[model samples]
Target: MKPQLLPRKSPRQARSKALVTAILDATAQVLVERGYAGSSTNLIASRAGVSIGSVYQYFPNKDSLIAALRERHATDLYDTLDAVLTRRNPQSLEEKLSAIVHGWMLAHQLEPDLHRVVEQEFPFFERAHQDQIPIYRTIVERVRQLLEEHREQLLPDNLDLATWMVLQTIESLIHAATTTTPLPVHQPAAIEQQIVEMLTRYLQVVNPR
Candidate 1:
């Protein structure tokens, strides 16, 4: 059977929530500094200043802790996407694209080291679309709504395919820009502008005056 990745139980009270948060925070730190091989439940417990038993109280093993961290990270990304996609004021397609690209990059930058570790050390962390990976689908559907709202300005007849391509392009490029080194331009605004322009041109977005 596959290793148990889910937590043993969810934290209920305030103290329990705090304990769980500490464990997850420590897990992120260890994963970033030590990579997967070196990150053990013992090490994570020590980092969190908790006992091994306390760590195992919620998580069965390192895999479970990692899985929880992945969920937390996905939630953070979803929150960022929601912030842009659910704006009260209306925005042009290019404006929305810029907001999402910038917001997504900012969210990743908030934990760049941990992000790199998650993506590199545990490749499965980002394998979305299955029932286990609902965040990817959630994000895709949110973008689809945005596209539907601007259907008149959009060029693609198939919104689903266009949404997939748009997300792939942004995600692939942003991951490359953040994870890889020695990029030609390091200014985030410049990179975001380029991404927005690329998407806008691809979508054939026409903003009416």
Candidate 2:
């Protein structure tokens, strides 16, 4: 049997969307201020200036609310990355890698708190969360494509390994940059350049003159 789908929203859907957004925004504020243990549906409702029943009408429980918020945060990050990657055309390998790293760092800076909530508090809704394998796969595929286009300059038989290494290294750098305490002494551009340099050294196949 086919699975049942949820009903489509009508004109009232706009209002519902706005209400849900308000609740999620309020929830984020509360979560950052008081942590997970202190944030409750009642508090979210009060802060959102909506009825408690209204909050329940949208989110059945705290876990559901948080799961939705996590999804939203991920979608927003992806959208920003997409825009940056779409707009840039780097003339050289170094320029391309720098663009990618800078784009990622900018996205992280744009939503550090949301990223923190997802990375730190998202485990509570493990079952609700989706796998990020596709995200990593896409990054690797893009790197591989770029490498292939520059085969004359850097021909590596193991493109898969190169792509994986670059993706993993950049991912770890961003995660560390976002989570580190007391923050690092270096500026954002310095950090981005550092990541770009490290990845380029590992992935770039040197051609002996």
Candidate 3:
């Protein structure tokens, strides 16, 4: 078990809220324009037009700031997943999976470089904010149910392992697609189809076990 990196407190008032928003917005630009090494509190404050003290008021350190950014990203992705779950197509697992995949895809596309920086440059950030990762458990649970419901269409046993693979496959591929340099062509429709096709086929037992 690890402690979650977090801000000192959340913004409550309208003015303070605006300041936090500006700070985070500026943080994103700094992260994009400058790598993690260059994204210092002074630089972020200067970019945000707020005093460096204001930054410290909300975030204790650079790591905390980065963690908050990661938290924001996680929230967006989870919200997208929640929205997809609300109207998931019951008859078509592909449609349901596609919605989840595309929702997360859009979330990553919101800040690709920052996402890369969080994942590649400071992988520890993920560990620091491990608290937020469980939001994704809903996806895995839903997937497990899908596996059980379609047991005849899928393998008899190992539904748990299959579910993990399906979740990881979508997550890893999309993360690579968004973060890799000399990035692969991101034809949304084609990518979605390929993901759905691969996942569907993998779950489908051609030779029954």
Candidate 4:
């Protein structure tokens, strides 16, 4: 049987929301410091400064909290990228690529440790959120739409496949640069420039800059 990997209830009131946020924040810290094996509701509750009962009041167990944490992290990232991608300001494809790569890196930079842990355990969290729209799909669809806007300038005939390749390439490079140390491109500015240039070339931008 599948474990109950969801909150027992949603926190609606401001106070309840704050309490839940505290719990998830503690969960992230604990997961970062101790990893999934070492984490537990007891440790999370203590870290959150809440009673175990209070923890159980919302989350059924530690896994549920981790799931919630991952969900929140994914939502926050999607929102950040969505805002950047959906903005009305006109931009060349290269400019859009730069903004998106930087935005993704910036979001991960804010919580690098937690991002690493949650992403490593994504399969588990992925299962927990199976009923909902995947965040990655939403971001990809948005980027694909951006590509559709400039199809004439792009080389790939299939924008859908091209979008996937582009996003996966950007995500893999940025994820490695942020989560792993001693990368070839260690600085954020350098990484962003390299990625934008790389994707622009791969997409065969009509007029190379």
Best by lDDT: 1
lDDT tens readout by residue for model 3, 26-46: 988898888888789899999
Who is ahead in TM-score, 1 or 2? 1
After superposition, which runs of candidate 2 have C-alpha atoms over 4 Å from their true positions? 1-12, 125-164, 182-186, 206-209
Q: List the residue pairs that clash in candidate 4.
A: none
Models, CA RMSD each: 2.6, 5.0, 3.5, 3.3
lDDT of 3: 0.76
* lDDT score of residue 37 within candidate 4: 83
Give the range where candidate 3 is weakest over 10 consecutive residues by summed lDDT.
123-132
- Residues 1-209, candidate 2: write the lDDT tens digits: 32111112212577787888898898888887777778898999999999999877767777667766766655665666667667886867777777777777766776577667656775455522344334544555676787777666664567777766676687668867876441464677777888988876666647534
After TM-score superposition, the amount by which residue 127's alpha carbon in candidate 1 deviates from its true location, in angstroms, is 1.8
Give one digit per residue, the lDDT tens place, for model 1 in 1-209: 56778899999999999999999999999998899988899999999999999998899989888888877876788898677656734477777888789778867777877877877787444456233756757878888888998998888989999998898898778877877652555687888899998998899876543
Screening candidate 2 with a backbone cut-off below 3 angstroms (N, C-alpha, C), the clashing residue pairs are none
Q: Identify the superior model by TM-score, candidate 2 or candidate 3.
A: 3
lDDT score, candidate 4: 0.80
Q: Residue 21's C-alpha lDDT in candidate 1? A: 97
Instruction: Output the better candidate (2/3) by lDDT.
Output: 3
Q: Which rank order by lDDT, best down to worst?
A: 1, 4, 3, 2
TM-score list, all predictions: 0.87, 0.73, 0.80, 0.84
lDDT, candidates in the order shown: 0.81, 0.69, 0.76, 0.80
Model 2 Cα displacement at 207 (Å)?
A: 5.6
